[model samples]
Target: MKLPSEFIEKMERLLEDEASRFFSTYHEEKANGLRFNPLKIDRETFLTLVPFALSPVPFCPTGFYYDAHEQPGKHPYHAAGLYYIQEPSAMFVAEVLKPNPGEFVLDLCAAPGGKTTQLAAMMKNQGLIIANEIHPKRVKALSENIERFGITNALVTNETPEKLAKYFPGFFDKILVDAPCSGEGMFRKDEEAVQFWSQAHVEQCAIKQRHILDCAYEMLKEGGILVYSTCTFSPEENEQTIEAFLQTYDDLELLSIEKVHGIQPGRREWTNTNFEEMERTARLWPHSLKGEGHFVAKIKKTGPSPSWNGRYAKPNASKQMVREYRQFEQEVLQTEIEKPMYAFQHHLFALPDHCPNFDGLKVVRAGLHLGEAKKQRFEPNHALALSLKPQDVRYSLDLSSDSVECLKYLRGETIQTGEDRGWLLVTVDGYPLGWGKEVKGMVKNFYPKGLRIN
Candidate 1:
């Protein structure tokens, strides 16, 4: 738990008296947290069903503090996407954004999708959310987390901020720029972050964040809300960054963020210009709060920007593909998918409401991936299973969380169920885990191999 000299020197000058409390936190164990997916399960029900010692995070209603000793990540419920394991303070970012249902939201720099999932839940899986990650490799993890959370309205993409600005200018109603920064705040949770720490890196991050923010601003509609946040405490990446953004854009207004639950305000003195309105930003210090550090700033687009003029995604499924899918839907699903269905070669997807065409964009996933249509048959995807309720399916195989069969299913192993039901929705205590197809008495495991617990 050795602190870096440069980091210590910079912080001591910034804090003066409070530096000791902030540095003392480095010796403490990192905070552990999990936020229940409201789309999958309610908070009260989740508390009753889960097997763990948990306490609620005061800042975030959905977030719960799990003991560091607990291995909730290995639990079958995790595979089922019942809850997302996230850092406690990191969960607060989405709460500040507070995206409502039926809104077009953008999660700029979304990787490993903690905030994206939370924003999806807040949106109630209704609106369009583009979770963009610049890194090609990290976007896969973001896409996977989006699937596990049963997010039906997200379009996972791997593209630069500049690229997205071109396609979605003035389109999104709300946006989250969870800007990448020097991992000053997360050093406790990830020791690697401490090793990577340097003053030079912090300056680079500040420059990069400004560039990312400029792109995010372009996509937000006039009068739209945009939340900028970071996991680091560096003034260059926090108060200073927000001040610079405000200075650059005359139309942007720094909106007040309610400071509760031991949260503090941004120091105006930290900024080069000593921007007075910078105090509207909120800071979650580890010493002040029960969680690790974070900084958030909510802003509104006051000036007019050109509205997006793009074609909405049309139903492109062939007549034969439609007929085949409809037949399967009739036989297996009790609910109807009334949304626009699009096809990419043999793969079928139910397009989200008001989804725009992502032509030429590097889309990793587009809306709810229904599955592929091969020949005359349509295979249901694991995403299709996770999004369903027990009643939505014609038949199901329900298993206990700790049952041998549950472990088998998570491990991508098949089981004998003695049922002839086709397209079975496998559940862990009534929450949809994944899909399994029945052939005679053997239920073939369709749990995605990439996600196999093995």
Candidate 2:
């Protein structure tokens, strides 16, 4: 747990009296947390259902503190999209934005989809949210998490901030820029962060964050709410970056973040010019809270944004594809898919409401992936199964969370179902896990092979 000597020296100089308290936190075990998905389950129901000993994260209602000894990731409920394992402090970033249902939103720099999922849940999966991650490799995980959370209204993209800004100018009602930074906050949990820490790296991250914020600003409409957050505790990437952003845009106003439950305000003295209004931003110190370090700043755009002249995405599914899918839907699903259907070659998707044309962007996933059109029949995607409830489907096979059948289903093993149901929704404790096709007395496992446990 050795920290960089330069970082230690900088912190000691910066904290003065509080350096001892801050340094002592490194000896403590890192906290583990998971947020129950309110989109799938309620808070009270989740509390009673979970086996692990838990405590609520004061700042986030859905967030719970789990013991380091517990392995919730291995549970079937996790596969059922009941909850999302996330850092407690990281959960607060989405809470600050709080995008309402039907409002267009953007999560700039979203990867691994923690904040993006939370934002989508807050929006009740009604609004269109574009979760953009710059890196090609990281965008895969972001798309997977969005699907696992039963989020139907997200458009996952792998594109640079500059590219996205050109397509979505003044399109979003709310935006979140959880900028990449020097991993000062994650040093305790990740050894790589400790090795990567440097003052020069912090400065580089600050520059990158400012550019990302600029792109986010262009996408936000007038009276839009934009929240910027970082995992690092460095003032250069925190107070200083926000100060520079506010200074650059006279139309942006820093809004006060409620500093409750061990959260503190950004230090005014940390900036180059000692920006006093930097106090409006919030900081989650490891020593002061039950979570890792984080800095958050919420702002409002007062100036009018240019009208977006982008074209709305059109339904591209052919008549034959629609006919095949509709035939399957009538036979398999109890509920009708009322949204516009889109086609990507043989694959089919239900486009989110008011979805803009993603003609040039590298789209990882667009809206709810319905399924793939195979020959004369249509096969449902695993995403379609995860997004459904027991009542949504015509037939289902429910297995207990602790049952051997549940584990077998997750492992991509065929199970024996006495009934000869064609397309059956597989569930763990009444929660949809994935799809299974039953023929004769044997159920063919449709749980995605990539996600199947060994």
Candidate 3:
């Protein structure tokens, strides 16, 4: 694990006495962590269900450290949206944001959705989370992670920060800019980051981060919280970037981040102005914590903006489609969808609370995708199955995760259940995995082919 000489040289001069400890950590195994979905399962229940040996991540309540040898990602529970495998230090970013339920939040530059899902969990599926990513390809992973987490209130979008700022315009109560950086903190986890590390790249990332933060500021409401984070330790993207941002926006105040569990404060001397208040930001050093590196800064917008006067998403479901969906819902679901229903042609979706009309945006998922109307019948989507509780569905096929049948289900194989009950939710230990429609004595697998365990 060879590090760049220049990076090491700079760090050695900066740390001086502590540089040895930091460099020594590169020879050690990288830490692994997973955070459970509080929206679906509690911590005690998750511990009882999972077979892995785990330890608590001190900073994040939902986060746990798993052994590097363990393969939680390959488990059936992972498909069931039970937990997210994330870097322990990366989990600390969302904890700093602390989005509340029913608040309009934006996760700018969200891709492969680690922090976005955590923010969704904190919001408890009640708020509208506009999870936006710039790259088209990366946005797919972000949307997939959101779906796998059983998140129903998110509006996954593929759009640029500037474009989103134009559409939203001071609409969010809270925002998270987990800006793209040179990946200094992620070097241990992703080796490519190490290969890409350079001082010039760091400067470019800082410029991009400032532009993104400007977009975030435009979208955030007065007194709203905006958390800026990076996986890099470079002062150009951390203390210096925040310092420049605060200077540019006099109304934006840097709020103090409570540093605990070996978390350190941002170095004030790292900035151009040697800003003393820059110490309010937090830093997660690999040598100081159980995880790799990260930097987080929480700020507040004290200035006001014009109130968003956008139209809410209207119920566009036709009478026939509504009737068909209701018939399916009544026959299969014990609970009812109480939100406004919208239609994308034959597909029906229950819009999130206070959802603004995203008519022309590149929305991967609008809201809780109810299902699609095929001919005269309503076929429920896999998203619907994952979002449901076992008690919420009328019939289900519960299989032990260790059993061969569970593997078959995950592999998209039909199960031989001796029940004629139709539209059944398949579960692994009472957690909804996917949809399995029962016909005669055979249960047809509806687990998505793309997600099938080969």
Candidate 4:
């Protein structure tokens, strides 16, 4: 890996004794970690199912580390949305943010929806969470993950962070800026990232990080919290960039995150620059810990800012889209699903009331996603579909040894649950397995084909 002269020079000046060790070798193995979704399953139950080689990550109660001998993805638990594959250090940012129920939040660069789903689980499917990913291609994965985890209170949007600030100024109670950075920290996991390593790349990433932070700050309401995080380990992109932002905006003060486990506070002094006051910021080193490198800082907006002056307009959806959504709710859901699903920039959503307030702001998502309703019946969304409790349904399978294993494995094959015919909810000791319509003494499988275990 070729380090930039300026970055290398900066590192030498910053770490007079440690400079040689910093850039000499590359650790090329991927860190192993997973985050549990508390919304669908409890910690104790999940731990019992994991392989012994995989141990709980001490820093995060919900996170775990496993040996690479087996593919966790191939496990039935993965198909159940029991956990998410994530870099261990990256897990801390969302935990530190601590988004509660009934608070408006944004994940500026949410994709593959790891942190976004974590935030949703923390919020307990209550409160509004807008997950914005700029790339259109990544939205599918983001949307699918949200559904897989049974999230009922998120609005997934495809837009840049700047566009979000324009539509919602002083709107969210909390915002997460997991900014895109040069893949320095990801070198171990992605060889392509190493191939692109250069001083020019680092400098370019620093510029983008600063821009992203600026936009995150603008979208935060007075007294709102903004959590800035990155997967890279560059002062230019981490401490230095934050210091520059502080100089420009005195109202944005750094707050300590001492409560989180598995993290050390940021260095009070970097290079020749001493920052005794900035210790509130946090940094995670892969070498120091069991995970990859990461940086997280919590900032609070103090003082009033000008009201957001952007034009507000209801999201316009094709009549066909609206009809499809409603028809599915009426027929398939059977229950009266919520209405006037929030719309934003050509998208429409329905969320439970537990979601946070969207009044006086541009709503990017609204309502519990009930999947798309169509043809007088509803097609269950992976989100709502995953949370269906067998007890909620009129018909269900009896708790048997084979039944339990089958459900746990997420096998597509149907089983006798003692139901004669009609819709039946499958369960393992009373957990929901979406819905299945039964006929001729057998239930038609409603488990999503893509989500079934191998």
Candidate 5:
């Protein structure tokens, strides 16, 4: 738990009288939190269903604080897209830039999808949200979380902010740049942040954040909201960076963020010119709250922007593939997929509403992946199963959360259903777990291999 000597010195200078309280928090156990998915279950039901003792995160209604000893990540409900484990302070970032249903949104630098999932849930999975990450490897985790959340309206991509800006100029109604930082706020949660702490690194992160913000501003339409956030408490990357950004763009205006539940305002004294309007931004200090540190700033674009002329994605699935999928849908699903069907070779996907043509972008996941076309028949993807309710399918095998059968299913073991139902949805406490295919009194597990628990 030893902090960098230079970082300690810097914080002591920054906090002055309050430095003692801030340093003392490091000795205490870090707070843990998770937000229930409203897309799948309601707050009251989730409260009754989950076994862990939980308390509400004051800033976010769906967010809850769990004990450090609890492991909600290992639960079957987690795999069923019931909730997402996240940092309490991190949950507040999406609340600042809450996007409405049917609004086009962008989560620039979205990876491991903590904030993106929250935003999508707020939107009720109705809008088209582009979750973009620059790193190839990180984008995969982002896609998996999006899938696990059963989010059907997100277009997960692996592309640089610069490239995205060029293609989606003035296209988004709202944007979130949860820019990468020096990890000062995440030090308590991740020790690597403490090891990597340096004044030079903070300065470098500030430069990168500003550039990412510039790109995010380009994609946002006139009168659109752009929320910039970081996990670091460094003024160089928070107040000072926002000050420089506001100075650069005349049309940009800093909007006031409601400082509730021990949340503090951005320090104007931390800026180069003592920018008085810096108070509009918000800071979540570890000592002042029940979670790790974070900084958030919401801005509005007042200048006019060119209207986006991008083409909407077209349905490209062949008649044969469609017929096979339709047959599978009729025999298996009680409900039908009415969205535009898109094909990627043998695989098929149900494109999101008003999905744009992602011709050149490195799309990791395009909306809801329907399934794959195999020979004369169609096989459903695990994503398709997770996206459905038990009532949506004809047959299902419901298993209790703590039962050995649930563990067996999660471990990719075949279950003895003793029913000849061709396709069945597997569930844990009435929530869709994954897909299973039945032949003669035996259900072959279709749970994804990579996700199987050993």
Candidate 6:
């Protein structure tokens, strides 16, 4: 990979004797880290379910390190939505964001939904989470993952941060801008990333990062926290971008990140700029930590705002769509689940509030995900399906290990269950996997395909 002339010169001065070594070699260590999905199972239960071969990550309480020989994905617990595979450094941003239940949060660049899912788990599926991704292709993957993880509080939106800002000015209590950047940090994992590295690309990404941060700032309420993060190591995309943003928005102030054991803070000085006081901003170097390169900075919007003429315009769903959704909810899940569920757009969602305003923002999903009703029985959806308690349903299937594995892996035509007839909530060690109906000594599978263990 060819570094920009200016960047190379800067690295030469910064590294001095070690500059050549920094450029010549890449860190190739692969560490497996998994984030526990609190919505489906508690931390203790998740750890107990993990195979003994995978070691626990020492620094982060929720993160675990898997051995090279282990296939963590094949485990039944994985299909049960017990945890998610994530790089250790990538998990830090969500931990620092620390979203609470019943708060409105936004993930401006959410796709594949790692952090967004974590936010939902943290919120206990109670509050509103707007997971926005501008790219259309990635939205499918994001939506599937959210369903697989049984996240009910999330609403996916496909729109740029600029457009989103116009719809939701100061609407969110917490906003996370995991901005897109030149793949500097991912170069070790992906060789092609290094080939695309150039001065122009870095500068271009830095500009986009600034725009994303600006949108995040505009949408966050006063006293709200906005976390800006990237998977790149370049100062231009990291510290400098943040420094520029702080200079532009007086209402925003850099807040300190309480240090974790393995993570180090960002450099105090970069090029001509000094960030000594911005020690709260963190940088996880692949060389220094068990994971790949990443940067995180938490900033709080302070004081009163200049009242912009922006208001949230509620989304008007057609009466026909609403009526159909209500009937579907009433027939399938209204009695089966105790939570308040409603329909927004074409999707049904369950929230703490009776009626939520779905306005200018494009809402991909709205109410509690009651499984689609087929025949005379109601099937449970993957969303909030795993979180159901045993007594909440009329029937449940208890299957053997092989049957459970086959059902989880989506490889079985029929599952043997003790229940002769009636709908049964399938489970592994008391954690609800999903719902299944038993007929003639066989359990009908309802596990969503995207969520099925592969």
In order, the Cα lDDT scores of the candidates are: 0.92, 0.94, 0.92, 0.71, 0.94, 0.72
lDDT of 3 by residue, 226-337 (tens): 9999988889999999999999988999999999999999999899988999899999999999999999999999999767778888888998999999999899999999
RMSD of each: 1.0, 0.7, 1.0, 4.6, 0.7, 3.9
The residue-by-residue lDDT of candidate 6 on 1-454, one tens digit each, is 4545665686678667857755554534555678777766677776676664566665556777776677767766666677888777788889889999989899999987888888888888777888888988888777767776777677788888888887777778899999999977776667777677787999999999998888888888888999999998788888889998988888888888877666778766862468675677998766566777689999999966445455332434445544554564454342444445454434445543422455565656554565443444334466656656655555655444345454542553457655575556777656567766677777877776555544
lDDT of candidate 1 over 1-454, digit per residue (tens): 8879999999999999999998899888889999999998888999999999999999999999999899999998898898999999999999988999999999999999999999999999888999999999999999989999999999999999999999999999999999999978889888899899999999999999999999998999999999999999999999988988988999998999999989999999999988899899999999998888999999999999888998898889898888888999999999998889899899888889999988899988989988888877999888888888899989899999889999999888999988788888999999899989998999999998888887
For 247-304, candidate 5 gives per-residue lDDT tens digits of: 9999999999999899999999999999999999999999999989899999999999
- Worst ten in a row by lDDT for model 4: 356-365
Between candidates 1 and 2, the one scoring higher on TM-score is: 2
Q: In model 2, where do residues sit more than 4 Å from their true spots?
A: none
lDDT score at residue 2, model 1, on the 0-100 scale: 80
lDDT of 4 by residue, 1-454 (tens): 4554665676678668856655543534567888888987898877775664677777777888877776777655565577898888888889889999989888989987889988989999777788888888787788788877878777777777777777777888899988888867787777677677777887798888888888888888899999988888777778877887777798988888874555767776752267775678888866457777788889999978657555333434557777776665444444554544554433446655544344554333454555554555445555555665543445565443234546543657665544455655555445555566667766767777777765
The TM-score measured for candidate 2 stands at 0.99
The TM-score, computed over Cα atoms with residue i paired to residue i, of candidate 4 is 0.82
Task: Enumerate clash totals for all models, in the order shown.
Answer: 0, 0, 0, 21, 0, 12
Task: Give each model a TM-score.
Answer: 0.98, 0.99, 0.98, 0.82, 0.99, 0.85
Q: Give me the displacement of residue 156 in model 1, in angstroms.
A: 1.0
Candidate 5 wrongly placed segments (more than 4 Å): none
lDDT of 3: 0.92
Q: Which whole-number lDDT from 0 to 100 does residue 318 have in model 3?
A: 94
Clash total of candidate 1: 0
